[model samples]
Target: MTRLRLAGLLLTAAPLALALPAAGQAQPAPNRTLRVAPHADLRTLDPVFGSIVITRMHGLMIYETLFAWDSKLQPHPQMVESVSTSEDGLAWRFRLRDGLRFHDGQTVTTRDVIASLKRWMARDTVGLKLAEYTAGLEAEDERSFTLKLRKPTGMVPFALGSAVGQIPVIMRESDAATDPMKPVTETIGSGPFRFNRAEWRSGARVVYDRNADYVPRAEPADGLAGGRVVKLDRVEWTIMPDPATAAAALQTGEIDIWEQPGQDLIPVLSRSRDVRVERYSSLPNQGMLRPNHLYPPFNDPRARLALAYATDQADFLAAGFGDEQWWKRCGSYFVCGSPNGTEAGAAPYAKPDLETARRLLAESGYKGEKLVLNSSYDIAPIGRMAEVAAESLKKIGMNVEVQFADWGTVTTRQQNRNPVDQGGWNLFVTTASGATMQSPITNIGTNMACERAWAGWPCDAEAERLRNAVVEAVDEPARKAATEALHRRLAEVQPYRVLGQYDQPYARRVNISGVLEAPVMVFWNIEKK
Candidate 1:
């Protein structure tokens, strides 16, 4: 069933190419250029420095990983020719596949892989945990590397194969040598596509040309794993901040795909029989509200709890997902309906009471403190949620200000950990794929490691301890107990709020094919007629 209600908004015609028949049905122009309008601009291509879906998508295009997970959620070797573990399980060795070479014509060696893993471990949440267990990692040969662990862990493969944000993308040793905290400016990898730097323009357009030297695995493509064969000669991403403009472009075939069509504009695109609207993945993107824990009114747990009470899940859900059927009022911090999902700390969110919120705020001594709510309308759903949150905050007698920017701008600013007065943010609206939030280990926002924590810089000793327990839990029951405990603690601390959960839709010309049903966008199997 379609999830959008009829929104009375006029559509404007935009200049775009002509539409071709559906994939395998008709031939496109002689020049095969796959035009795309992604959800946001490609602000940062360095996957280690950014966790946004757009950045991950970019990384998938120009970079390759040693291992990748398939649709069944099983890890498969991508660049690795083979892998083996010692009897004690404390040592693991991986051999690189033959013919693996970076775009610069350099072989992908064990030294490069070790350097990339080291840089990634210094940043990613899963990488940090992996580092803690890793006693030593060194190249054993030109093509093979070994990781000596302090303890036996079954998560080694999963960690290396993870396709979530902050993915451990392999790169040239020289490029990987860049500081983990800084972005790697060069775009060189063993992936099937090479960045067309000459045609790059920030906030305008980015292009990728198919790598003729790339070789595909014998296996069929599935999710981020298996064979990655680029059928198109080139893929160009045109950043259109305005949904109407992007929708028009897709309709006119000016672009081959619209990665994330705004919810409000979905109805307009639906009216076009020539256009096809498809959900990105089976897992939905969850709406979230992350609060700055360094200072505030929010630094106090009571104040954060007041904000949670101030929020009405129904309002945020309705704003983000127009139709009620498309979204859920997920009270748990974890993605509801997942294996470890529980209602442990959902009591306060059961019913929003402004009166209780007022009492809590008074108790916390909040003195009309101003909160800057950074919102990006480039994606309508996020902007709408922020608007709703701002109104709710204002109703509770707190000063709320909504700052406008594109999704890229918000992501860049969220990296700043300065005081709110010095261009820092109080809270921001964004979404996380349910695939990434499936566990405490993969979820970045769940970490409470003080200065090293995710963007919010939250610190909760109990939460951190519970997170570690979840990691160490061996049995299903024990993992469930640990997750429930952590969920309850998160509810009590309120480092971040799960506003709602909804799916993001993508629109493309009928001719486009091979859009994977994976959690992250994969352009490998796609082809244009």
Candidate 2:
């Protein structure tokens, strides 16, 4: 079993509740709310429109998926009651569980599921691959649907249940019918929580109320699967950009949970008796440096290789996370310690080589052009990693400029495809959960689909072919072989630089319990005492 480590020293501390009610306002009962300090501000609510993790968390809170993954990485039915495949394995049928109702008092039907899957497939990597093999998808009845594929593959259920980048969340047919590239105005779903749109304050707070009409699974909660029993009447997300203030809030009982606390503050938080720092997921998060492939310097593979040769994973990891126990050097494109974490082709660039970097830079014909490195100061780790990258690139004789902004602004600016002088970026630093980087099919960083690729716009025919082989392999051994080949290809192409892997522990009050172990932050199955 995956263990949840509780780190804190026992000490006498005064018991305190949340903020008192305003003048003339009635005070609510104790322990009826779960207050959280999220890692980033909630800017977008449409999960299918982008790969933002915060939006994915918001979607999970209000929307339900047809299937879900357990801690063991096994796919199981969530909203689905039963699923069966044909003898040839080309056709699959699914039936929704009874009593599933949307927050707007509408019954969940096959039309909603089909529309949601169609929109999700238009953006998610796994969904796109599934669409390639899909021959037909249609509703059989109000509560059932059938999907026919051109070839027999096991990706149907896995794709539907995957909780990776841009999760496949089921929404109302009316909302799902919106353009996949655009955001939906309405926030309606059949999940455990109903989004409080009227109470949403963009940069300050987001609110959700328990769904009284919703019915959960009978089984106990495990990872993202099983029953999602909500014990609290309300889940309030308070956005605190500063790490110090967030830690202070967690320690004083102003907030019940702190989704992410910096490593530098973990020690102080651990010393407090009221707060417990726990590792929620066994898989560590993987940090990456993504370069724009459409502009100069990085447009050439040699230049990308030069940057890779100059990078030191240890330096990047140490700067972002102070303690060595929280981080490790990783070279694999896929996350280290995962099922496909093989360092097959990373032998040459295992250590930093300034000579190789300089030589490669010269060969690529870089002319000291200004390279903008977009970074977010609000997220301390990302800002630190960008600083290290800027220094490393300078060592390779490249003109580097570090642009600092809040995380929301950074995320928005990186989407611009203009040149550096026109607000475009040459590189940026970010991290993905280990579960998202466990496979070539799921890892958005390794996607080489040219114009259709993730923000980086990496394009390589050989890399794409290798990834497809891994996805379409007949057996586990074949898939492993294909993945190693893809890894070797990625080393040559240098699509992105893998800084390292590290664990981001969660800090919550002692009164909070039943936190399910998962790669992502989940509200379900958690209760306040």
**The best candidate in terms of lDDT:** 2
Per-residue lDDT of model 1, residues 127-233, tens digit only: 88788789988898999998999986666766887788699999899989888999998899899889999999998999999888887676667788777877888
How does model 1 score by TM-score?
A: 0.92
Which regions in candidate 1 have their CA more than 4 angstroms from the true location?
1-31
Off by over 4 Å in 2: 1-31
Q: Per-residue lDDT for 363 in model 2?
A: 90
Separately for all candidates shown, the number of backbone clashes (residues 3 or more apart, or on different chains) is 2, 0
lDDT of 2 by residue, 1-529 (tens): 1111111100101111111112111222324889999999887788887687898888889988988877755566788877776777777877788878998888999999999999988888878878888998889899988888998766666678888888889888998988987778788989888899899998899999988777777766788887777778889999998999999999899999999898899999999999999988888889999999998788899999987899999999999988999999888988888888988888888789999999988898898988899998778998999999999999889899999988888988877888877888999999998888877878998888887778888999999899878767766678789889999999999889888799999999999998888868899878788
Would you estimate the TM-scores of all the predictions? 0.92, 0.93
**Model 1 vs truth, CA RMSD:** 9.6
Kindly provide the TM-score of model 2 when superposed on the true structure, using C-alpha atoms.
Answer: 0.93
